[model samples]
Target: STGTMSAEELMKRGKRHLSVALKEECVNKNHVNLNIVLDHLLSKNKEIDDAETLEWCKSIIAGDKTYKEFLEIVKSYNNSSICGLVWTAEYVAYRCRTCGLSPCMSLCMDCFKAADHDGHDFNMFKSQAGGACDCGDESVMDAKGFCPKHSKNKDRSKIEPPKDLLFVAEIMIPRLVVRLVQYLRHSGAEKQYISKMTSFISFLQELSETGDLMQQIFSNVFTSQNDYTTYMISKSDVGVEYDIYEASLKFDTINVNKYFPELADDLIHKTLLDEMFFWVIKSKFPEHLVTFLLSILPNEQYKLAFVEVFVEHYRCMMVELTHSEDKSSVSNSVVHISVQLLSPLKLAIEIVTKFHLIHIMFACLKHIINQARYGNTLNLTSNVMKEHCYWPIVTDFINILAHPPIVQYFLNSTSLVNAWADVISSLQGLNMNRREHDLHVEFETETYYKAFSAELEICSTPLWALLKHLNDSSSKQLTINIVNILVTYLNKWFTENSVGEIEMNPDEMSFHYPLHRYLSLLISNALQQQGMELTDLLPSLEFLEILYLHPLHLLVREFFFFFVFPFNFVVGTYKICYV
Candidate 1:
């Protein structure tokens, strides 16, 4: 019987039957081996009973041909007739309206010319990127539009997908789920656990690369419309009326239970939480672990739990570092880890504000500053600061404030002015001890003077920017409060250190000049805003008068004049009595 059929016909038949066998529910559901499915299909089909054809089929089924090689072979045969060509943008392509099953079906010019379309509806257009010839793809083009070479086979009936394939899929998917569950349930060793997790991540990444395959599997096997409806109905029973559109918009909140209910178990949640905490503490791929956890547990409660853990850990570490007498023995690694953990939440404004993270950060700042202020001789040396973890921790908090939402929350709080004033006063108090020769030598040699100046600049610049940001708003009192803080610090600085002291140690001037410049800028900005007047700037002018009388550093005096002269001219010329 096979002797009468052409090789093309026989190959087509074999391909059709193979496609059917692969789609069989039993094969997919039962996870049947390809060889077994091929054997069964071959036994059922008498067409490939001949020894040579049998051997060819068996060779492919037995995995002698790699999947890629098999695919190449199939592609070679499929493209032999029609030009299986792709076109870039601006290239000419043809489409047969009569034969195209979809608008996407296209043909190369050569293939279009080779085919007969004397009475058929066809059109030519420039191709877009990724446009490919579909002349020989039966699913895309009807038989009537097929090129001469591809039209040899007249059969155009639909072939049902095999139940065996579905069976195999069902079986394999559940097993994979079980494997993932087991990985979470049983922790053998750290390396093994990380390896398992990494492998799973790799698998998911690879799966994602297969276009639409993951989506199809998720929709067809993992979840369905029926399941979504059932979940909504269940919610409705709890007095929440089911609104599909709203529910769809909030899919993340409901997806864990609807798409993968098994994963929604309390034990699984606890295990995930435990693993996340462990990884965070271990500092082992914690970011990746948190990313994975957040993807699965999109519930606000879950996020709140994570925030609680991170906040608790952060507080504990800050307290420990502040209190630890041997600063050298204390590790800032955990503190940095907590910062890394909480850093992602900065994007989540609601979570950050709702959890009062800004308040917590301020509390942490005060705790560390208080400890340094009263507990120990606050050192400005680079090595000492590093050992004390002072600059790093403070810088972390400041960097967090750099985020707009966090800063907005900070600005809105009642403690905003006092919190910043405390920090400024603390830095001033700490730097006072730096004036001793040995300490100054240590600071200058280690370049801590420049570093300290940079720290003050970093601190003041953001506050100045925030003041300008609030200049037009009704928060005029806020601006005045901040201005008062700056003026108070400037006054303290001028009265505490003499001009001779400043001249003796220019490095000390360098250490303190950033604050002065920032203060001048703040004052100049405050005068420009509505409802602000010369009277409001009296304290600042008084401090400048104190500066004018003293033989201050040339840069400092020039900065004060540059700031005050314009204000005196523009704001009704309030005469400053330089005492």
Candidate 2:
């Protein structure tokens, strides 16, 4: 009779038998139902594979007809109460503080169990929801031990004072800002707070070897004026210097403590500083504040510390959006964070470029571009870049690229250009389904297209605008800078080390740039009849001649053949005769 049955029919028969077994044995029992049921199903059914078991478990969790009926038979069965124990486990245990206080001491739950944690005497241990085991203090496990313990009761009178007071002073800045804002409208209270802050600042200045740096850091925060006055003044209040620094000082008196507490707390400082960092940018406080903070710490280590803080804060906000289920809040929060970051980041790029801190700048830009390229939460990248305000930030960065000093610095080193190109190349990997198959790849062709189009537009906009204005008479120096930048880029391609493939096709004019349109325009505008004498063009021509002399990269050779060949043919004949 069983010989006629198919595999599917056998599975159904097995499931029926398993349901009856669960009803008879699992009723009135509060245990791991899934695992227990899985065991019972396989007790005699050796033919039931792991895949079949998983399918059955999924069906039960989805509230199958038989599973619901089984649940009804269990005594005092609340799904939540049992689901926790079922999914995780029961009875979490931690180390016992007392070795032999009671028989259950060693087995007691809820003690802190870090390897280096100091021991303590205690009674009943705390209870947690699930099965987790704890060993003794962390020192029991850490072979190298932990941080050095300083005596809490040591007298300060005998100890020499530390040379650097910046750490203490940095904490004071935010605390004082909070104090000043707390008493904003009340002049008497505000004055008193300012006096106290100034006194503390003076003492720190006395202690600091780098007193000038401390003074620079606190310069704006120490400047007190009526912050509330801006709100009082009407729109018609024009031509008045409203003390925008003070205007940005406005803070919620009641909730301000939540951000910055009166007592010293590193956590509160970190939280408040992060909020304040974003606030300064959003409120349009001068960029000098960021510059000052960065410059105060001037060394690479400190600048990197500040950059790490900015990046970590950004990453945290984005991670929160990734895990969140609330769609509307995610969108609003992302937009808020993105807009706040734009100005400060632009200012950061400018500052880093000015200081010739290429590595730090590259790191910062890489983080920004990567996040914006691959961000999937609520379509954050697309939304943020699409905003009108976002472009000004991009334009500011583009302006930096147009600046002669920055361009010269970048051109002298291929590392910066390569770093920038690497960021753009990361987008290409997102589109590489045709090259490699990944089951988990979230980026599809459409996503790649959108990102590619946006990236191209952003990278091209400023270059195009700058190139279009190069023909003006007053733009000679700008033209020289542009020429230097172009020549450097072209020179790299023509170098023997460069891979010598044609990157741009001769026919597809639309996709060609940074070489095609820029070169054509530079040469067209500099022609002998166009008022640029042969002398004026000699430097650019000489640079190109150098590129032509190397003769390795196919793009450079093709470029000479296609564009420069004709120009040289017409002009070199007459120019040679004059020579």
| TM values, all candidates | 0.42, 0.29
Best by lDDT: 1
Per-residue lDDT of candidate 2, residues 259-339 (tens digit): 223312121113323334443333232222232333222222333344534443332333333333443343343332222
The TM-score obtained by model 2 is 0.29
Against the unseen true structure, what C-alpha lDDT does each candidate score?
A: 0.44, 0.36
Clashes of 2: 7
User: How far is each candidate from the true structure, as Cα RMSD in Å?
Assistant: 18.8, 31.1
Model 2: residues >4 Å from true position, as ranges? 1-176, 179-275, 278-363, 367-393, 398-448, 491-517, 521-579
For model 2 the local lDDT of residue 26 reads 32
In angstroms, the error of model 2 at 91 is 56
Candidate 1 lDDT by residue in tens digits, 69-148 = 43343333222333334343467988887887553467878778878888888898874332456666554567677777
Judged by whole-model lDDT over C-alpha atoms, candidate 1 comes out at 0.44
